[model samples]
Target: MRRGRIDYRMQRRAVLAEVRSGVRSVGDACDAHPDLVRAATHVGAPAREPCPLCGEDDLRLVTYVFDRKAPANRGGRAVPRESLARQHERYGDLTVYTVEVCTACHWHHLVESFQLVTRDTAVG
Candidate 1:
């Protein structure tokens, strides 16, 4: 099994830099698809900090999990953190994504991504 993780902080920082430097507009960055807008609006854990784009107190942290069997699994549905612990046992290969979103401004960023697999199944 492939065991690896990816962090998207650098990518997010690059995008933020573009926005701050006037190379990209926050509106452009926040102009997400309708489905994403709806999901970000209703799903995920509420964040305490205000939105970096619009200064709204409506940010949230969203998590999405995918397995080899279902790569395109569930369309941006909000999965509770507790559920992930259960998934680790069921799937041998899993990719987890954590995303931060500002519901009020429609701003969304991929916070991080990591792999999860059971010790019994992970290959050396």
Candidate 2:
């Protein structure tokens, strides 16, 4: 259940626009962390679109999950997209974050986030 979802397309567009208009350098826009690139290579889902910054076909979508009901809500883990349903069943009121990454250029940005319903909160 993707409830309370927030889309970050506008922010992504703004960042891209800044890169294009010389406000932000390509290095600034494409500098994904090492761990993130590793996650994108291993667990990321192939995106439908190419890398917006580099025009490469290596864009991937990585998903991370955190328990909203837990204290501090820290230490989120990167999860494969295929296992989201099982993950949702295991955690109550979870927060899921999805990011777009380009394995080629190291570009990355948060694309969307939403709450996952546990068994208790699941609707029929």
Q: Which of the numbered candidates is closest to the native, going by highest TM-score?
A: 2
Q: Which residue pairs in candidate 2 collide?
A: none
lDDT of 1 by residue, 10-118 (tens): 9988998999999999788897566665666666777768877888888887777787567464543357655777776776567788788887778898888777766
- Cα lDDT of model 2 by residue, 85-121, tens digit: 8887787668899999999999999999988874446
- Model 1 has an lDDT value of 0.74
Query: Model 2 segments beyond 4 Å from truth?
Result: 119-124
TM-score of candidate 1 against the unseen true structure: 0.78
Question: Candidate 1: lDDT of 117?
Answer: 66
Span of ten consecutive residues with least summed lDDT in model 2: 115-124
Off by over 4 Å in 1: 1-3, 71-77, 90-92, 120-124
lDDT values, one for every candidate: 0.74, 0.91
Mark the 10 consecutive residues where model 1 has the least summed lDDT. Answer: 68-77
